[model samples]
Every structure is written in C-alpha cells, then in structure tokens.
Target: MATFYGGVPLVTEPIKTPRYDFVRAPIDQVNTQIKNDLLYSVSNLPVVGQTAAEQRVNKDVARQLLAKVYLRTNEPALAEAQCDAIINSGKYSLVNARYGVKAGSPGDYFSDMFFKGNQRRSQGNKEAIWVLENENPSIIVNGSSGSPQQRRVWGGGYHNINGMIPADSLGGRGLSRIRLNNWVLYKLYPQGDMRNSKYSIHRQHYFNNTASKYNSIKGLPVPYGQDKQYTLSDGTTVNIAKSDTLAKINPYTLKWGQFDPNDVFGFGMWKDFILMRLGETYLLKAEAQVKQGNTSGAAASINVLRTRAQAPQVSASQMTLDFVLDERARELLAEENRREELVRTKTLLQRVAAHNTDGPSQRQIVGLTANNLLLPIPLNEIQLNSQAVLEQNPGY
Candidate 1:
C-alpha cells in the first residue's frame, strides 16, 4: 500500500567468489564483450550473419535495462517511456491466448504452468521473446537423476520420494529444508484446480505399474505405503531412503493422468524455466505508468494482461501500487524472475517480508546489494580477481 525503497528480495543467493574480480581491466569493456557472447547462443538469430535479430534483442534489453536503472535512479518519466516502447512494440503480447482460456476446470491452470507439452513452441511459446538454447534440456532436482532430451520435451523428471525431499548436499550437510507456504497452497486451490492436479501425488495403484510408451517402466514408482524401493532401467532407486520435503504431489506439478494413485515425481525437475515474457512486461509498463501519474494508461495495460489471464478487468480506482505488486506475485509465481522484478521495483525485502513474513529480514539476509543488478555473473571472474572482496555481491 505504501511505497518504500532500499530493499532487495531473494529466494536464493548468487554464488560469490573469494577473489571476485578477474578477466578484464575495464568492467564496462568486459560487460560489452559478455553481451556479445550472449547473443551468439540463439541459432535463428545470426551469430555472425545479419545483425537485425541482435538489434531486436538489444532494443528490448535496452528498454528494460533503462527502466530498471531509471526506476532506481528517480527518473520516472524516462522509465515510463522505455516501458511504453516495450509494450507498444507489438513484437510481444502479454496475453498467452492458449493458456488463458477457460477449460471450465482447474486442471487447465495446472496444465498451463507445469505441463511439458504446454511449454513447447506450438503452445504459443511465442510469449517467450528470448529462448535459451538448451543443447540438452537436462536439470537436477532434489537428489534425482536426469537426462537431457526427455527433461526438455514431454518426459520431464520429477521426484515423488515420500514428500518434499531435500537435495543431497543440503541434506547430507544436514541442512534439511523442504516446505511450501501454506498460503501459496491455499491460493493454488489444489482441489478442483487443474493446475493442482498436475502436482506430485501418491497414487499407488497406477504408479506401481505405470505403462510408459517411451523407454522403460522400471524407473516409475510402485504404489505408496509400500516399504520397498524400485529401480529404473537407468538403475536409480525409485524410492529414496531419506527425504527433506514431502509432496502431496497432487497439487504441486504439471504431471497429470489417471494412474494407480501412487506417489511419483513425474519425469523430474529438468526443463528450462521461462523467466521473462511479454505478459510481465505489460504488467511492468502499466505499473510504471501508474507510478508516473498515468492512471488511465496503467489501467489499460493491466487489463490487457488480466483479460488474457481470464481474470476480471481492473479500473483506475484500483490501480494502487500495492494492487499491482500483489497481482504480479499471483500472476508470476514460480517464474524465477519475480525476485529480480521485486528488486527492480525497489521493494523486494519489504514486499517479500510483508507477504512471506517468516523469512529473514533485509540487512540480515545475504546475496543482495545495489551493485549486483544483473545476476548470472561468472564465478570464475570472482575467483581469479582480487577486487571482489569489496565488489562481490552481498551473499555469495
């Protein structure tokens, strides 16, 4: 409701190196080179061919970065203008047409968020303006095995080990932590909501004898309440001995189908998480406009997205910063980019604590600072360089 500054929100801290500053003499110069390298990852965009695609990315990046800097620097109009450019560019739209439609059931919501098939190119993956080229889509989950191909496509990997199991290192090191916010669970409406149905659940009957059309059925688990473990064709044990977090599973992932009703983790947690989309951009632009005294403009922007989400339209009277903030939290949950969004909006700690009061406070927390704007910075640079002691991010 009230606006405040000097806060950073973080679900996880970035890795910090001891030495912290190697690779190049001028940081700006090094960053320019790094930017060039990032552009080369996409195949459709010419790494060496025409520069138009690069130009497109650059424009989008510049517009976003400008708002980020300006918002933090007190140049509201500049930030507003840049956001407008992104919104009106028409290159992207916040509305995800396919996912937003009413399937007349909660199942559709679950399918949209976690279903591997829903994320493919045909499903209006057009929302993803920038696609990270995954040579192989392999990912690791709380002490689970993964393969590159299946994780990326239809066969995602999941862990249905009892409940929320901790990752090996965290658990081995005795740092057990696997709990979901009850509020989040309640809001998820796991009952009839289709999205909730896709999560990890214990369906013993179908699980014990899953008939997969793909490789082998050995990896899937047997029905729950049984003590023994099953091994997959890959030789990984189906039931882990110790787990940190337990999943009701039914309301937690994109996995859905009529099974024996045993607990399982699905394909596993390997697929790439799409962090940015035109939808969030639309929301951000609208919020910026609201902050800059453009109530009408802000209303239009927010409604464009709400319309797509299938939620009711919001008028100018309801265009408070608090409303926008909560709307974003609900709309963009689990996107992995919300942390940065809260930070850029300059209200991370306050908003997070206000909503998730159980976490650590701002200063007491680690891995956030004014300078550490862009994450994904290489650790090697920190290890090789010495200035890192003063410049390395707060929580490494």
Candidate 2:
C-alpha cells in the first residue's frame, strides 16, 4: 500500500537502519553537499540576505530533489512539502515558446531552457532552470593536436599531401576503414530523411575497423546528374565525361555519406548533448498528477510537451501508465540515462526482463532490494570516522 504521508511505499527496518556505516555517511554527505550547493555556503553558514538569485533557485531545486529522495525513503509529508515549496516558489515557470508564435512573427524561441546552449544567456532564455557545467569539446581534449582538435572523432588518420592516411590511423593514408553498420545502411533510412545522407557505407566489406576502398565518390560535386557511374538514390543517369574530374572518385575508402558535419577530427563530431530540459519537467509533473489521481490534468500537461516535438499528444481515451512509460522512453532517448531512471521508478528490471527475457542487467537487478535504490556510500567514508557510518549496505 502507498504510504500517504510519505507518498512512497513502505520502508522496512533493514532499509531504515542500513547495515553499513558506508550507507549512512554518504546520505549525510549528499545532504550536506546539496545544502551547500543550494545556499552558496551561506544558508548553513549564517551570512544573511546576501544570497544570489541563482543560488536561491538552485537551493529550491535541490530541495525538490531531496523531496524525491524522501519520497523514496517513505517520507510522504516531507516529499509533498518539498514539492509544494518549489511549486509555491513562484520563481520557476512552465513556458511553451511555440504557442506565442504569430503570423509572420520572429519572436519564437526554439529552445528548452533547462538543457539548451542558451542557459547562460542573460535574457529571453527559456527551458532549463539549472545545469552542471560541461565543456564544448575542442583543443582541450587532444594534446599536441592543433587548437581545433577534440578527442577521438573516429580515431583520426589523414594526410594533406597525396591524400594519404595519417600516422595515427594505421599510418593514416586515408581512412583506415571505410565502414558502416550494414543494418544502419540498409535498414535505418526510410526515405526523405537527411540521416541517410549523413551515414556511410563500407568500402569493400573486407576487414574489421578498416575500409577496403575510397568513399569520397559521392561528395565530389560534379555537373548535376553526372554521377551516373554509381547508382543514385533517385535512379537518375548522368554523363560521366561531362562531370568534373574531382567528382569521379569517392574520397572514402569504404565509408560513404559518413562525413561529420562539423569536420572535427577529419569527420563529423556530434557537438551537443541537451539534457534535463523543460520537456522532462513536464513529464515529471504529469507523472505526479497521475499518481495523485488527476488523470486529465496529467494528460493536459503532457500534451504541451508533445506539441513541441511535433509528435501527436496522448489522447485522453488512451492515457495509461504504460503509455506514459513508452512516451518517456521515446522522448527521453539518448538524453537521460535510462538505467538509473528505471531503477528509481522500480520498473527497469521488469521492463528489461520483458524485452530481453534473460539479460544480465535484468537478472542482477531482479535480486536487488529496496536498499539498492540509492547510490552506494564510498569506502573512504568508513575509514575516516567510525561513527560517520555504522555499517555497509547489503550490496557493498
């Protein structure tokens, strides 16, 4: 049964006491870190009325997160109180940028404030509320590489003269491998999608991690309709003799259409990883609404998010927990770490078993108890102070 006061399930004795000093200390450390993070070391330090807006807002978020932890630990009143604190803050907002678009208008912001590159901007920024710092990869990653370099964009190999591979990529004359997953090349493209144009094909299908032939044949722009030597997607023919000499050879040995748009490390590098933006916050609120028995309210909230992705909104007639889970999976792909999320929701292990039936992660987690819900307290905490922690958790 749901613990109404805590808004969480029941917590047993072993989970409450926690066997290891390892367990108790980390919770204290996390709580301390969060309080510090929230207050800018001021709330607990007693420096009054000097708090920054960002620090204030961050503390509120930290409080909300703590509420989630509390709920997991079966502290419903604290969880609800924490949720209400942020909800009542009147500081944060749920905004839909596209709704304001007018005819011939330029006031539209295509951003999710919580996860986009605009979080640091001074004004009109939307979506993300708080985010941890991460660098945009560049010269910071690779040593001895020029100022433009980043780490491992396809293990680099190219020579400026005579078109040879570099010393790094098997003495880099050209790409050491001209390869693409056959599944990707053959199955992924569904027509009219740019991803097909973005992917590559293997050169000779000869070896692992290395291509057998050149791939630039497609990229060399020639007279329109002149690349008749190779099969075209549209089945058009061309006059090879009239085509530019540069157009005849594909630059890739076996890799086709796999060039990086950024041209980092001699190939395309994926630049951005947008995480925990407004979309997720919408989902979170929706989940909370459904949990509270307000189904229509949950559906209405979720629709706002769907409209942005240009995906169809969840119909009230079909709104269900399963649908929400699937929607979460679909929308959060590649952004949120599904592993941790599944565990927290107490749904991942079962879902994995249903899909793979016998996967290792599924089996391992099947035996996990409530204690596994939280992160482990590191071993170092046990050594420093005997009372700092009383015992290690079962898994540890």
Candidate 3:
C-alpha cells in the first residue's frame, strides 16, 4: 500500500464497528508499521523445513518481504542485512540443474520449474519459497480461487490462427491479452542466454490442426515472416503480414503454460503459482548493495544468477540501478509484477520512455508524468471517509 499510494490508512486491527475517521498516515509511519508486522511474522512463523505444507509462509518469506520494504524505503543497509539472513539460512538455492518431473523431458531447468508437476519443493523445485497450490475444481471442490489467466495473458494466441491448434507443446490455449514489447523480444537478451532459449521463451509455432489444409506441415515450424506468403499442399495460399503478428505469432514466455487433457478449453489452469523464490533474493541483495555504493558486492551477488543461467558474468563497473532492473526483467519475466518494481525503484517514466514506446499509437504507453509515480487514491475511498479529509496524491 505504501509502495504505490505512498501512505494509506493503517488498519492493523479488525473493524469491529463502523469507522470513517481513518486518515492516511505518514509514509515513515507506514513503513514502521510494516516493519513491526513483518518482524512479528518473522518471530511467529516456522522455518522452511519445519513447515509440512508447501504453501505456508515461513520465516524467510517474512524476511524477504521486510527486505523489499527496506529497499523501497531507501534503507539499503538494513535491506542488505535481511537479504543476508535469507541467503545465509541455507534453506533455498537456485535451480542449477535439471531435477523435476520433466527432468528427462526436452526442456531446460529454468523452464521446467514452471511446469505444473514440477513446482513444489517435494516435486524437485528446491528454489520454491512460496507456492500456492491449485488443483482441478471438477475433482476437488473449490480447488482454485478463480480462473487463472496467467497462461492466456502471457502465452501467444496461436490457436486463433487457421492452421494451428491447442497443444501442450504450444503452451495450451492462450489469448495473448498481453504481448511482450519489442525490446524484450529482440534487444533484451544476448545470444546463448538460457533464459531466452526456445524452452523458456516460445519463439516458434508449429502447425498441429489436422483438419486444416496445412496438415502437410504438421509438426513443422509455421511459415512466418513480415509480409510473407506460403502455398499450402492443397494449393491454398496463406499470407502472414507484419500487421497480423502482434499476438498470433509473437514470442512469449512459457512460464504460465498449463494444459489439461481433460479440459482442453483451459477455462482455468490447475498449476501452483510460485509467489516468492530464492532467485529474486539475490537480485534484492544486489539492489541494496548498489544503493550503498558496494558495486563489487552487487556484481558478485548478480553473478550467482548469471552463473546459474550460463550467461556472461558481469563486472563491478557494469553494476548500476538500470542494469539490475534489466537483470530483473531477464530473470523474473512473466513472474514478477513489473509495474510494482518500476514504481518501487522510481524508474517508471525513464524506463517506459526508453523501451516501451514502440508499436502502434494505441499500443504504446503515453502521457505518463511525475504525477503517475504515485497513483491517485480512489474516489470511492475518499467519499467513504466522510469524517476526515483524505488528501489525494500530488497532481491527481
């Protein structure tokens, strides 16, 4: 709440009676409240191995949240201490080798952790800090909260193509409601980066619909290019123009792909959502280090992930706030809430102006200003608090 809207009403206790006199607290007060609550949680919560349930929050989870709060509040040294506690705990580590349900399958270790059967710690994902388990609602009543659209939002809407079909290898059925920007697809990754591999990011689509005239090209790469044409086996010509490839054939991350043979329509995905993991702990530590002018320490912290990813090791000279954010994009794409990260780092305007201005006018991000740093408090919230004047954010 404090991160996005500065300081919101601190309702720490349950509302036993009607109250409308609540006013926004100072940002410092909010941070102190957050720290107290997290410290309480850290004291009460069990350690990682002590919890039998994988979904339950552990002490490390509280520490991670506290670390993030410290970072947002510009207490890098304190954040670094929290991060050190989690890292030195020896409870979590990065997924360096293939060890999951799909370990024998044709996929990388990074992508394997996102698979439905390979998410939890018992399922061989040692790096899973917090995983929300979801099951098929048809068999288990009230299994999921609601239909999860992660797959549809991140995966390509290739099934909309005439000669394509929903398949497990094709990331099931997706609507491509959100397409990755051109910078992510083209300029973000260097060659041989495992995170950008075909397994992690689905860059190619193949024809699988047997009923279509392009059946001859089944199990073959879809003929896609900017304004290119191809003649099918039945002499039917197909033209995939540049304008038609925004969502249909665009590249997307495979982290949210979950397919069920029983539920082909995929109204909901029955896969565990990894909320927090050790991979991000390293990034948080690096951010804190960079803030304290410990560039060498930050480089060492980031190289832990780089070595796991098999990407080139970075040096202390290359360590910057922008570089750390880029590494976040590369390491935690599709998993991290990017807007929150940018807002927390106060780089929304600069980063968006630099990398998110491509594509059509409607698709581009525009009119963002300093005022957008903190969102306007909702009108309903202000109207409901009639007993007090709830000030709004600046320039709202």
Candidate 4:
C-alpha cells in the first residue's frame, strides 16, 4: 500500500461496520507499522522445514518482505541485515544443476525451475521460498480460484501463423496480449547467457501443422525478419514478414507456457506460481549493498547468480544502480513487476525514456513526468470518506 501511494489508512483490527472519516497516515508511520508487524512475524513464524504445507508462509518470507520494505524506506543497512539473515538461515539455495522432472529433457537448468512438476520445494526446487499451488479443475473441485491468463499474456500467439498449430513443444495457444520490446529481445543479454537460451525465451517458431505443405520433415523455421518470404513445397511464396507484430510472430517468455491437450483454446493455466525465491534474495542484497557504497560486496552478490547463469561476471567498477536494475530485468523479466521495481527505485521516468521508447509508435511510453511517480488517489475513495478531508497526491 505504501509503495504505490505514499500513505494509506492503517487499520490494525477488523471493522465490523462501515466507517468513514479515516485519514491517510504518514508514509513513515505506515513503514513503521509494516516493520513492527513483519518483525513479529519473523520472531513467531515457523521455520521452513517444520511446515508440511508448501504454500504456507515462513520466517524467510517475512524476512524477504521486510528487506523489500527496508529498501523502499531507504534503510539499506536494515535491508542488508534482513537479507543476511535469510541467506545464513540455510533454508534456501539457488538451483545450479538440472534436477527436475524434465532433467533428461533438452532444457537448461535455469528454465527447469519454472516447469509445472519442478516448481514446489518437494519437487527439487530448493530456491522456491513461496509457491502458490494450483490444481487442474477437471481433477479436483474448486482447484483454481479463477482462470489465470499468464500463459496467454506471456506466450506468443504462434497458432495464428499460417503453417503453425498449437503444439506441446511450442507453448499452447496464446492471445499475445503482451509483446517484448526490442531492447529486451535483441540487446539485453550477451552471447552465452543461459536465461536467453531457447528453452527460457522461445524466440524461434517452426512450421508444425502437418496438413500444410509448408511443413518440413524437420520443422521448417518460420521467417521472422521484416519483409521476409519463404517458398513452400508447392513452389508458392508466402510473405510472413507482414505477420501481426503483437501475436503471430513475436518473441515471448516461456516461463508460463503450458499446453493442455483438452483445452487448446487455453482459457486458464493450471500451473503453480512461484511467488518468492532465493534467486531474487541475492538481487535485493546487492541493491542494499550498492546503496551503502559497498559496490564490491554488491558485485560479489550479483556474481553468484551470474556464475549460475554462466553470464559474464562483473567487477566493482561496473556495479551501478542502473546495472542492478538491468540485471533485475535479465533475471526476473516476466516474474517480477517491472513498473513497481522502477517506482520503488525512483528510476521509472528515466528508464522508460531510455529503453522502453522503441518498438511501434502506439506501444511506446509517452508523457511521463515526476508527478507519475505516485498514482493519484482515486476520486471515489476520497469522496467516500465524506467526514475527513482526504488529500490527493501532488499535481493530480
């Protein structure tokens, strides 16, 4: 609540009746309350191994959240302390080797953690601190609360292509509601980063429909470049360069891809969501370290993830706040909310203008200013509290 809006009403106890006239507390007060609550949770919550329920929250979860709160409140030392506690607890570790259900399959270790059978702690994901379990509705009643659109939003609409059909290899049918920008797709990662491997980010598409003459014995590569054309087996040319940029042939993240044979339309994704993990903890620690002018320590923290990913290691000279943000994008693209991270660091406006201004004119970010840092409080919320004068954010 304090992240998006500077201040919010602090309601500690449940209200049996509707109440108005409540005023927004100061931002510091809100942070203090959050810290107190999380400190209590850290002291009282059970350790990781004691709980049989994989979905339950533990002390490490509280510590991670508290670390994030500390970072937001400019308490870098406190944030680093929380991260140290979690790291030293020995409850979690980064997944370095291939040890999931698809261990023998053709996939990298970084991508294996995201597979359905490999998400839970019981299923070899040592990095997973919190996972929201989801079950197939056909098998269990009330299995999923609602249909999740993550797969459709993150995966590409490859089925819409001329000679392609929804296949298990290609992530199921997607509506392509979101398409990756040029900066992320082309220029983010170096040559040998495992996160940019084919298994992690499905950049290439193939002709899979057997009925189409364009289909090859060894799945013909679909053309992707601008104004590109391919000759079919029937000696006819198909212009695939003009395919829909948003859906038909765009690169997408494969983390949320799951193909359901029964539901080809893919209205819902019956997959577990990894809410918190140890991979992100290191990033948080690095951020806190960088804030305290310990760039060497920050570099060491980031190198742990880099060593696992086999990406190039950095020295203390290259450890800047901007570099940390870029590393966050590389590590947690679809998983983390990019806007929230930027807003918390106060780099949203500049970063957007630098990297997100490419791609199509319609899709580009525009008219962003300092006032956009905090969203304007809803008019209805202020009006509903008729008894008190609820102030709007500056320049609303």
Candidate 5:
C-alpha cells in the first residue's frame, strides 16, 4: 500500500443520492465517485503495521469491491481482470478441508466457513476475505447492536413445531422469516453436490423432547419407514397419514447455527458473518467472461468451483449468464444478498417472475416490469424543494 495525497485537496460528498435536496447529481456521477473511492482504497492504503493475514484480507476485499463496481458499470473486461488477479494472487484459496477447532469433524468445506469460530483468517479458513466478527456472548458485558441475524432469517422457524423443544441439532430457534424459495431446493444444485448435501442443508429432523404425547417419535426419526405410524408417549398407537406431521418434517439449514449455551432463544446470533470469500470471486469472473462472449473461458472459471463441490462439470455450450447466476445461487445463497446480485445482472424481475413459486399468486410477478427496476426518488424530496423539482422514477 502507498499514499498518493501529497498536497492535493480531494473534493468529496456523500455517495447516497440526495433525498431532500433539489438538483441532485446524476446517477452515473454518483457511481463514478464510489468507483474512485474504492479505487483509492485498493491502490493507496498503508499496510506498514498490519499482519500478513490482515494485509491479505484487506487486498482481497479491495479487489472484490472494485470487481463489484466494475460489474455494475458494465466493464466486463475490467471485472474479469480484477477477479483473475484475486484468484491468482496466492493470498486466498478455497477451503477444501476441515481446519481450525473442527478439524477431523464430519463437516464439509462449505459448512465449515459458517461455523461460529471458523470465519476469520487467523481461524484457518483461507477462503474468508472479510469477516464481521461478533464477540462471544459470555464475556461481553455490554450487549451489541447491529448483531447479525444469519440464523434467524435463514434458519427455519421450526419453533412453530408443536410439542417439541428447540435444540442445537434443530438449528436453534429460527424465525424462518426469509426461508429459501423452492428453486434453491429443487432447481439450483445438482444431486450429491456438497453445497446442498445434508451437511449444508438439514433435510431430516427427529423429535427431541419427551414430555409431550407426540414425543414417542422423540428420539425416533421423521418419515421413519414411511409407514406414518408412531406410538405416543402414553403408549397410544396413532396412524398419522401426513408425512409432514409436527416434530417430524422440520427441514432447514445448519449453516447459520450459532448455539449460545446461555440464551437459547435469543434473537441475535453471535457469529462471524463472512462478507467475501474466494468462491464468489470465481463466479464473478465467470460472469464477466460470459458477458464478453468467451463461453469457454466462463466454463473454465466456473469449473473450479464445481470441481471443489464435486458437482458435474459444465461444458462451454452450457455457459450462459443464467447458468452463472444459478451457480451463484447454489454456492453463495445465504452468504450474499440475492437481490443485489440479481439486480446487478438486470435479471431481478425476470428471475423473480420465473422461479419464485409464490410470485404469481401474490401478484408480485404481474407487478414487475422494467419501469419498477429502479427505486423512485423520495416524494418528500420533491415536495420540500421549492427551487427545483426532483424527478421520480417511472413506475412509482
């Protein structure tokens, strides 16, 4: 890292679009300012006293941010070049084996990164680029704000289960507010792919409590034998026809599980959240290659990720922007913002209308169009400005 501001006075303003001010700058100008700031961070930050791992992580983050901005600006060559540099830098690598405290455990590389203590560079996952750390619940005297809800949003609210207690094996008490759409489970990952395996997604659940009458299956597995018959805690044998009976059909994810022995039902899941990792950089490169009409190069970029997950190799003929987006969904589902990714590719409305099962019935599918692509400028801004009128987006 080097300093570049010898004596120059750089002009700066807030990157966010003005809501209450009249005569706001154009969107492209704001984007240019953001791009310049990110470029400065990548090229001019000092790394004198930082540890080796810290320097590596900082560079990784800076490059990734630049690549993201490049993607937004439709600079495919620049985006692909940035991604290639990160992949070839030797500072980061895909986490292929169990490391850190969970070494020799029964977890795969994909699930290892999401575990409570395995997210940082010092924690042994070289895949991590930028991690948001949460202090341990026991030692922190003052409670934390902005604590992550990775578990609550991604994990199933199986607490809705009748006559069952929340357990670590069941991914704690998930609100399941942001459960996966059917496409993620049925369409994205191929069979036997590690990202969708039982290690990553919890497809089975067993009754764990013993007090209730439905607890006979307590210690018994769900959909066991498919006979749909279970003996009650009081010794009454009942024939349950539906396989999705309570205490049996809780299918969820274990990736965001952070068990706080102290507060089991606490809202905030105190675990380090991975902001960027090497796996997604590969996807970004593949996307840029596809945009540049180099399908073979895109396939090569994507194969690195597919090979690590033991997924079937993709051919150049199968390379498309949609394929790249699907791979992103499979590999970086809960780790990244799906909306932001889709919006970046300009496929948000189309994909939501196509793969979202609930979109049509809920009228969201019908409501989506090119006009609604960009958010409308706030109405208050227009009303407040007496000197000039603030234009709103087309739809709203």
Candidate 6:
C-alpha cells in the first residue's frame, strides 16, 4: 500500500495457504491502511529534534505522505487540507539565500541544499524535512562507502568526456551516466532562471591537464560560445559546435557536485543525501490546490519557489497539471522519481510519447500502452502457491 497500488495481495504471514494468499486486496483497502499508519505517527510522534533528529517521524513529512495518499484515494479536499497544515506550520521555510559554510561563496540557494554539513536542521537549513547522514567510514564502518562509489550513483558521471578530466573545480569526477532528456534541459525552465544558469549547471569544460601541449592554456575554460572551436595539443583545430560531437559534455546539472578531497580519483563523494525538503512540500500543496480547482492558490504556492529562483511567475489562468509537473522537473530534477510522478498523474504514456526523444529512437517506448502501466506479477509468486491458482496481471 505504501509503495505500490493495483490489486496486489497483502501477505501478512510468513507462510500462508495459497487460498489465503490468492485473495487480492482492493486498492482502497491498502490506501486506507497507509493513510491510517501515517496519521497515527503524525498524531503520536514528537517534533523532530534539532541535534539528534535520527529515526524521528516528522509531522510535516507524515502530512505530506497522507496528502499523497488522499490524492490517490480521490479526496482532493482532504489532500488540500493536509497540505494547508504544513503551509501554516511556520516551523519550516524555504532556504532562499546563500547560507551555511559557503554563504560568502557564489553558489545559489538551490545548490546549497545538497551541500555536505548543510543538509540538517542544526546546520541552519530549515528547508530540510528528512535527510540521510553519510559519515566517515573509519568511525561509522561502511557509513560512507567501501570503494569509489559514494557519489558516482548520483554524481552524473562525466569521465566519459573526451578531454575533461576529474577535478575539484569541475564538480569532482563524473561519468555522465545520467543524461537528461532534451525536454528537461530545453523546455523545463525559462532563460535566466538560476536553477538552469551557468552557476547551477556546469556547461563549460576547461583544459586542466598540464601534461598536454595545450598545457600553456591549462586553466583556460572553453565556453559554448557561438564559435565552437578548440586548439588541440598538436595545434590542430577541432570544430565541436554540436555538443555531443565533443568529448567534453555541456549543460550538465551541478546539484550533486560534491567533491571529496581524500578520494584518489575524485569519484567518491560522501555527502549526505537529501530525501525530502520544504521546496517539494510547496509543490505538493500546489498540486493538491490545482486538483481542487483553486487555480489562484496553486499559482501562489508555485510562485514562492519561482521567486526564489528569480524565474518568471506563474499566472492563475495558466495553472494546469502539466504545468505543475513541468515546474516539478525544473525544481526537483534528479531529486525525485520521475517515472512514479508521471504514473501517479496518469501522464506517463503521454509525456513519454511526446518528450522522450531517446526512448523512441531506441525503439524502447514503441507500442507502449496502458497495459504497460502496472508491472506483471512475478511468475515465481504464482508458481510457489500450491493451494490455489494465483492470477497474474494482464499482458504479462
């Protein structure tokens, strides 16, 4: 119920008869259980502590989960009211300025939320709702990592770039494994938006290796200027107007650019990962308000995040589910699960069919249908039960 929907059976015991296991639970029943459990925790748990905030049930997070459950349960008014509670709590506010250790630096507010030693309530970041603290492995024993993999999972691996080597200045090392869709880069935000600016996204590559012939210009940065040309070590000119044609990748997101100086290859980033923040809460509230036909309220909720980014404000007349999803991508890219969000809003097929350039080109999303929405039940689950025949999802 908490993770998935559909007519999945809830097996409560270790080994139950096939007759009992074959009985699938209704979607509403599972949603009710999830809602009850969250509300119980919200009503019984104390507020998150400032110092030892571990394993604590945050009321705002509980409310947010309940609101999501209500949205799936067809209770728009209930969802809206749950979000309203968090909005008026006054305990949490969006971090809208440079703060913490790097307040004097040139970094933006959005990027600061992910920095190490700055993702907790005690760290002066009031926006963090829930955070994962990754500590030093020497003291915490595997709390960080066993090898060179602390940040590579989310660091947007960039080592594949032709001449762009890993360094502290270039957002540590990256393999560029996670490439954004064309729509996420080009259509999600307006020009001049801080979230997509050069500061937030590392779009330039500089020659930093001193061993090459271009070593004289080692620190010379190459921008994606109109005249896309670079002189190689052999004094040969290379035209890389098309970003993909060049070894150095362009317009990569820098939100997860955490660098560990101790890492031999600069591939291990051991910063704490942010699970939930107030910025997303506002978006969730806006989504609930939009579903309830409160267009003005929805715009106001969304405008708070946009204003912080110094982007254009949204109008009440322009509020829609699609617009809300787009704003989510702009603000929460690589932070939340994209496929779940799209599936929850019933826009997976439509959005993918329209904006998924690579999917169609690779023949992956071809002939996708509603049947593809729910995953087929595992064949092992059906075969293991001997008392009764367990049914499988259609188009398995």
TM for every model, in the order presented, reads 0.53, 0.47, 0.95, 0.95, 0.84, 0.86
Give one digit per residue, the lDDT tens place, for model 3 in 178-220.
9988899999987778999999898888777786677666777
Off by over 4 Å in 4: 212-218, 228-239
Off by over 4 Å in 2: 1-60, 63-67, 70-125, 134-263, 266-276, 316-322, 358-389
* Candidate models: Cα lDDT each: 0.44, 0.40, 0.88, 0.88, 0.72, 0.71
Look at candidate 1 and tell me the lDDT of residue 159.
34
Instruction: Compute the lDDT for candidate 4.
Output: 0.88
lDDT of 2 at 352: 52
Clashes of each: 48, 41, 0, 0, 0, 8
Task: At residue 249, give the lDDT of candidate 6.
Answer: 60
Q: How close is candidate 2 to the true structure, as a TM-score?
A: 0.47
| Superposed Cα RMSD, model 5 | 5.8
Ranking by TM-score: 3, 4, 6, 5, 1, 2
lDDT of 6 by residue, 222-324 (tens): 5453456667778765454444422346456666776666663764466666777788888888888889899999999999999988998889998998889
- Looking at model 4, residue 373 earns an lDDT score of 89
Candidate topping TM-score: 3
- Across 1-396, the per-residue lDDT of candidate 4 in tens digits comes to 688888988899999998878899999999999999999999999998776676899999999999999999899999999999988888889999998788998999999999988999999999998889999889788787378899989888888877778876677888789888899999999889999999999887877777757655228777675666667788876567654566777889989988889988878898999989998999999999999999999999999999999999999999989999999988998999888899999899999999987767888988889998899999999999999988898989
Q: Which ten-residue region of model 5 has the weakest summed lDDT?
A: 1-10
How accurate locally is residue 288 in candidate 5, as Cα lDDT from 0 to 100?
92
Model 2 lDDT tens row, 1-396: 111111211222356543333223234444445434544522342211123643233555455455545544444455545555555555555444533212133222332232223343233334444543333355345322222212222222323212233332121223323222223334333343221222111121111122223243333433322433543344543234422222222222211112232452443222223333445655665556555566786788677766654455565656655556655654453345565656656676566545443323422335645555555545675565355443545566
Model 1 residue runs over 4 Å out of place are 1-58, 94-96, 99-123, 137-179, 187-250, 253-273, 357-396
TM-score attained by model 6 = 0.86
lDDT of 5 by residue, 168-241 (tens): 65567777656565677667789779999887888766656657677556766545325556667676765533
RMSD of 6: 3.6
